[model samples]
Target: MMQMPELLHSQKNSLFTAMNRFIGAVNNMDQTVMVPSLLRDVPLQKRDPDHGSYLRDAEADMYTYYTHLKSIRNEIEWGVLREDQRRKERAANTAVNAANLEAEGEDGNDLEQLLQYHLKGLHGVLAKLTSQANNLTNRYKQEIGIAGWGQ
Candidate 1:
């Protein structure tokens, strides 16, 4: 049996609308959500026109954002590749298993022998499907041009 999640409500407000809205806003991941806090907190300092180190915190923030964004993008890309590799492996295994089952029968006149022949046909279909899937995965990997991540 499954139970519904309880709605959170303030004593003054009967509905959970405010809490739900806040949760949704938090997950939106819009950089605008952080802008007001950043503007209020980070002080801007003027520097000489010729100096190299101008507004250190702002520069730091830019670098921080850059590194973190790059890290996350690479992580997701590698994750996708790994998932696709697993999928291809599973499909190939299915084809092999089907082929093995089809090869196990020797009595051609038996009812099970007919089923085996049908299964053998299904095995060929599965093998083609797996081959096409692997080909597509390889093509996508090439198009994306991501060789590897963190290695």
Candidate 2:
């Protein structure tokens, strides 16, 4: 029995791997790989409207939206990694300062302020990414006749 954290980690890794493959397929503009890859993971409902077997008409648009979303997500992931590194650096610096006792008067508030600013920016970027991804996914669902299971 996997622990909750282990399961979550596994899920996250799987999602990232799938997204990476999807990104590669989009970058190569290989519809043969991209279409089947996406459709294989997304199960079709019997009640879904017949928008053609492979949802052929919507594939191009969906790919465009998905690629744009992938770019946004990349940016967000970069921001998060940057913030995490900054946080670790800040903690290490604070620990060093505590050990020194001499730099206490110099004020580490500036570092804290900068970290807060970066975190806020990262938060904004992530929020925008989420919104964009959600919008694109919903649009794709609608176009492919998977929005609500039925026409």
TM-score of each: 0.26, 0.38
Best by lDDT: 2
lDDT of 1 by residue, 79-142 (tens): 5357778899889999997787589754447657777777666555444433433332332333
How much lDDT does each candidate structure score? 0.43, 0.52
Give the range where candidate 2 is weakest over 10 consecutive residues by summed lDDT: 39-48
* Segments in model 2 whose C-alpha atoms lie over 4 Å from true places: 1-62, 72-107
Candidate 1 Cα errors over 4 Å, as ranges: 1-110, 147-151
Residue 131 error for model 2, in Å?
1.4
Per-candidate clashes, comma-separated = 0, 0
lDDT of 1: 0.43
